[model samples]
Target: MSVDPEIHWPIPPKGGWTADDLDRLPNLPPHTELIDGSLVFLSPQTLFHSRAVSFFEWQLYHQAPEDLEVIREFTIDIDRRNRPEPDVIVVGETGCPDLNETRLPAASVLLAIEVVSEDSVERDREVKPAKYARAGIPHFWRVENDNGRAVIYVFEREPATGSYTSTGIFHDRLKVTRPFPIDLDLTQITAKRRVE
Candidate 1:
């Protein structure tokens, strides 16, 4: 896996950190997230993780429509104590692009992606999905780093249940028409990532 989150300290919110407290936090970690009213400080990402995220961000920007913007390590205010920072967020042209906005609404987010790390596998796969589904995000993409390569998983929300339905898994290339046509060659990207 490219990244592995060790949950530096699984500090619970026994009247601990609130969203307001989080906002007041002087030196928030580079990529801190609030999960189920608790604080989970993720471990630093590896070089491979940075390369993969950069690759995706670059590709999304190049291939996406003019209206779409690809952002990295962006945060969304989920609840009072549950703010999640997805690895990559694809949103429509938000007018306030200049500002370093603290949070983004769910409606503005078209797709949420999480590059699976060894320590965050369950959270990325099971926990985060439920939240994204409930937030009414149309699509979700999960990239599992396997020996420097990625196995892609795509899911679409089931409107009735506010859950997801797996579209398919891609091992070679990711070809999708929804959420604005995207055609990415995973093999080539991962190969280049390994060399870096």
Candidate 2:
């Protein structure tokens, strides 16, 4: 598969793409990410990925406190050369100022969640959590598809070490207290919803 030449793809500078370059890049594919000075173009999302993200987005929004906000498909500027977008982020109330904002600073993001797609398994499982932890994001969740079911791996950052420790792995339901008490039924992602 060849990239369309008409699309203006910017050449990386000497050190490779910076976090700010993402804003100026022309015709970059949606959800494009930068990792270790390299551009990562995401593959098309699968139905399972889409549904799981939506389910978590809705659940977090409803459960979050008045001072926190939930967002989906947004990037956090981790450093000069890395700005990977988590599938969902739970941010401080002031994290996003306006609807036009493209990204948030890592400090403002409280929790970053990634719903694993086949193409993003390694990154979601390993790379992203490390980046989020190093950036001082307090919490992280990795949602994996286990035989068509959602399995959430919850991690809390150890402030002393600046690393994430797995608090628990929740399959049928997710119950956590650190990041502002959240309880969700993992099975709801695959449950039927009534459309009015």
Residue-wise lDDT of candidate 2 within 97-183, one digit each (tens)? 888989999999999999999899999989999999999999999999899898999999999999999999999988888789888
Misplaced by over 4 Å in model 1 are 1-16, 95-98, 193-196
**lDDT tens readout by residue for model 1, 120-156:** 9899999998999888889999988778777889999
Q: TM-score for all predictions?
A: 0.86, 0.94
- lDDT measured at residue 3 in model 1 versus the true structure, 0 to 100: 47
Clashing pairs in 2: none
lDDT of 2: 0.91
Error of 2 at 16 (Å): 0.2
**Alpha-carbon runs more than 4 Å astray in model 2:** 1-9, 194-196
Model 2 lowest lDDT segment of ten: 4-13
